[model samples]
Target: MIAARSLFRAGAAGVMALCVALAVPAVAGAQPYPSKAIQIVTSVGPGSNFDQLGRVFAERLRQKLGVPVVLENATGGQGLVATRRVLNAKSDGYTLLLTSSGLATMPAIVKNAGYKAEDFVAVAPLGQVPFILYASSSVPATDIASFMSYLKSNAANLNMGLLTTSHITTMLARKFGKVVGGELVEIGYRSSPETLSALLANDIQMVATTHAIAGQHVALGKIKAIGVVADERTQAVPDLPTFKEMGYPTLVINVWEALFAKADVPKDVLDKIRAVSREIVSDPSYLTAMVPTGMEPWRIPFDSLQSVIDEEAKAFKKDADELKISFD
Candidate 1:
């Protein structure tokens, strides 16, 4: 009888030990994550253009997430700081980064940028701005025809003001200049705002920038928009004809800004973020608020974001090599 009782006790202890081991892991896996505030990092400063746009989405995300969405500015190096931070964040969904087209363009513009084209997966394309070619009012060109004519006789006197050579803005501008045999003089600014300022001062003959950046100046008659370099004429400035309309598609370049998270993030987290992003953009108020700022969310446009990332990175790599754009 004693032997049988000892055997029963041993069997019970084994079963109990197995149950504890399984339950411990199950409980840990079930723990809720992101039970606290979240963060959205931007490469632009407070009150800046990005900050204004980011704030709108941040507020919207807060409503959907039931968690505070904090906006942090990690400016300079053309958004490299913010990108690195996102890559280094813990594998939790609490951190996200709001970035511009530069997220894809910077690696090409800066040498040894330590990131490749496929580094960040796109959560969603948040917004887009059409790029326009503007000339200092000092230049006598008023239309595309006059602009071409002026380029013919005054090649030596012309200079192009650019924020950075790695930008799609300058790449498209360069190709257009080459096709027309203009070979414009190029000047670089530290930032887009600085480039716009130089254009108003007539520091250069022409500038390639977005609609909203130079819209106020154009309205004030301080600068003249020579052409729209985007796929279509923006509704905000319907009068400016697109490059395709002008019979030259090389000038078509739209600045697409999107949200990116590290590629290694969990699928459930990515899905949650993607769903929230799509919902936020679809909000009617978001459309109304963003349009006036010269931004538009593409409406169900077919974007295989993975493919877009690959293509942008390849194009930049090629441009950097061909133009010899490098930091070291």
Candidate 2:
């Protein structure tokens, strides 16, 4: 009996040791969130505004998080490829998406977007870039009023260039056409540069594109900016008046870029990211680098970020329905 009791005690001691050894690894694995590198997948390629902003954001994230932050440019599919890639990633907050306002229009246009704008929770807003209505120098319009008159008189002959049918600029262009009572022909191009090139060659009478792309040409007298599609005049072109200021309030639209993560990512992780993002956007150095790119700092409150995205998504869907616009 004494020998059996001693053996039982030894067995219990061994079992306890084994249990503790197993628990040790579990404890170590639970190390605070973000123990590994984070990847930011941008929806655009290098040299694009989205790519440039994403790189700067990644650098800032690395500085704050003390972890390697990688930026992957996953272009193509009209921003759907990168959007789906981030959506399919593990909901651990390690894989993030950096996309533009085009996200809001995906569901409205693409038949198999496979995701909605609200599917990903917004982590931070990068900035808002105003859209400019640029006209080829050959056109007889210098300002908004005269442009409206010219558009009405030459609606049958004038052609408007678009980067893509699904781009936000497409909706703005359509709205502009409605406001001016002209069925302006929209010619879709593969890219903004191509669209602008068409305008430069006088292949298209007008183009609605971001200020960043058209600002230089306008400054050099290559094209004329008829009006800006913003709530107010942008610092990039203070002399240019907004469509709203010229009496077209419905044309006030701006494209915004933002960071987003999977919706199911833990609240704590989202909070941490939002906190760091707020810090980065508010940094003077970040503003100095971004402002010259014709992007205005847009700091949507953390709590209001998702709501804003939802609203934009709804608005885009409404616009698409009204315009009968669909890619598929």
**Best candidate, lDDT-wise?**
2
Q: Which of the numbered candidates is closest to the native, going by highest TM-score?
A: 2
Tens-digit lDDT track for model 1 on 189-272? 877788888888878878778777888888889999888878777777888887678777556665766777777778888888
Candidate 1 Cα errors over 4 Å, as ranges: 1-5, 8-29, 164-166, 300-303
Q: What lDDT does each candidate get?
A: 0.76, 0.84
Tens digits of lDDT, candidate 2, 180-296: 777778888988889989999999989878888877888899899998888767777788898898788888676788998898999999989999999999899999888655577
Clash numbers, per candidate: 0, 0
Q: Quote model 1's TM-score.
A: 0.88
**How well does model 2 score by local distance difference test?**
0.84
Pairs with backbone N, CA or C atoms under 3 Å apart (clashes), candidate 2: none
Q: For candidate 1, give the lDDT of residue 261.
A: 79
Model 1, position 182: C-alpha lDDT score: 65
TM-score, structure 2 vs. true: 0.92
lDDT of 1 at 112: 78
Error of 2 at 283 (Å): 0.8
Per-model C-alpha RMSD: 2.7, 2.2
